[model samples]
Target: MLELFKIKKNHFVGIDFGTASIKVVELSYVDQKTILENYGFVELGLANRGNMKPTSLEQVLNDSLKKILAKMNIHNAPAFVSIPGFSGLVAIIELPSMPAEDLTKAIQFEAHKYIPSALDEIALSWEVVEKKEEQGEVKDNDNFISKLKLKNESDSKSGEKIKVLLVAAPKKDIEHYDRLVSGAGLEVKAIELETFSIARSLVGDEPGVFLIVDIGSRTTNLILVEKGLIQANRNIDAGGEEITSAIVDMLRISRSRAEVFKKEGKDILNSNESPLVVPVLDLIVGELHRVISAYKEKNKGSKLDAIILSGGTSKMVGIEEYFAHALGEEVRIGNPWRAIAVGSEMAPLTKALGASFAVALGLALRGVEDYKKK
Candidate 1:
């Protein structure tokens, strides 16, 4: 588990742990825009799979942190790390109108019904989604005075109800991340789930409806966001390593060599490219298709407006076109740094690095306390 450092806010560092690599981003406040201080990534020596144990992966994470921090000259800044979705649970639930004091209890009670872990062993948090009132008297409680006034002044009818999204994770998983950060000599101010972080960095204030497909090294996460709120999410058990493995088996090459081919698109023709690459790509697209179709079926009237791709594996050549072709929709690679300031000389590299740092950038964005309060 990672340790949290108590300090005054000046800079923030976001660290993302992926199956094939780890990314870190350092940011500082500038005039009106958030300036990018420094950013770098470390490739993991091992890839995550069902066969890999958590203990072995923890060591790799520790070593990777040491190298990433040293190379970027980052030491002792408040850090944010994201927990993988597979290790926790996230759900959206409808709760009856209640005082803010009772919301926490309501969320906890609801969590036990949705989360597989014991209620006492989980850490939880939730945000209220305000709905137009159809019929109800405005209460003057100290906790909700502002909300009551806003609701009363609105044109909504009495007794109308709104929906809220609740997110929870097991305490054991939180402790595990805390231990890792503490071991690495970094403070963990907050722990965010990767899906939420990706949504934050990719979607931001974008309106309407959009789906974010995060193709990581070991898992592919699908997130549906509407009006800046996460409406649905799912994680698939496939990622970049599958593509690499296919290349390795087809070309009869070392894992390291296959990884190079996967990234550089080198020696692809020499190998049985179509039989290997085509199927892996098709599998990824197929899973995405299923997830999207299910989302559409569940939503009924809602339609997906766009598709944004992020994560390390999303950098594969022709992937954007592949998704666009399969989904028959506009698919764009996400730029995590779109809202942050960067030097012109570094623009090209920043664009390349943005996709990989979606979660990390979102984590760092959280550490920007002043900006968030506004």
Candidate 2:
């Protein structure tokens, strides 16, 4: 995560540069309410998802962002951007409580175990998510004297355990997104992982654990969020593109035609052509089960409240019903715009855009949250 500029604007922009398209959302905060101002999206052909080189992709995104901003008449706004889930790491580590200085060094050492790149190549960040005593009770970090007393009492037994949320992203990936926003004439206010943005917009202040299954064009991000905090994150290489390819190969149709068929085919998951798509969904579901099981095994006595589905592919008809049946859990599509105010003129778009703009909206909401804090 990168924080470069201070919050100084009421109107904020969020850009989600996905593999298949670029989504931009502009929001304005007024009178303690967040209102939707403008939004734009440009679809990058599914067939060209992984074929484009890095430099080519950069040029395409730069041009697309510039065109979208110019068309929407949004200029020079402070932008919050999201790095793809596959390009970053989110891990929850538990260690015996110690001094602040020792904790910092311990987290750095733990980061090396999870991050493949060297420490110098990665931009690492961490925070003490919570501290727990031997009896499984949470300890407040703010009450230093009380916490010290409790620690002293517990020193003879088991020390208090600190659970830290560790986040790491490559420096090059950060610089890549920074250049994308800067080239489009927007100041880079902050850069965060897509997982955090998705959680912020969809699961804000919601109690209980949620697994956010964000199926993008080329990858699926399986985020296990407990009380709006990311507990475990897993990304799969299969996504909408894989489903589209199955349709193309099974029906012997062109990629462009298959793309349209995917969005228009109502109840396709249960139809005869269901074979083409169920595999991809099943792949994601299989990963979901593994992630949930791992999280449960690690943190006993915790239950996953629900599964929230987001991303373009989630807009498919009957998807919610299909997932509910498959997982036997309360499955629903996320509404990122639920808390944002939209006028009658834009109300019609709420359902159509539904879960697709979650990352973008979450990024924009971060700016609003920061402004409110100031």
Say which candidate scores most in TM-score. 2
Cα lDDT of model 1 by residue, 1-374, tens digit: 46443443668888887776788888887666688888888988674345678787777888888888989877688888878876666566666666656656666677778887776666665555555322232121111111101122223233444455566666776777767776777777777788877887888768777888898887888887777777777777777777788878888999988888888844342234463455656776777688678778877987788889998877887777777877787899998888888888878899767588898898888777434465
Worst 10 residues of 2 by lDDT: 141-150
How does candidate 1 fare on TM-score? 0.81
**Whole-model lDDT, model 1:** 0.72
Candidate 1 local Cα displacement, residue 189, angstroms: 1.7
- lDDT against the true structure, each candidate: 0.72, 0.79
Top lDDT prediction, candidate number: 2
**Against the true structure, what is each candidate's TM-score?**
0.81, 0.88
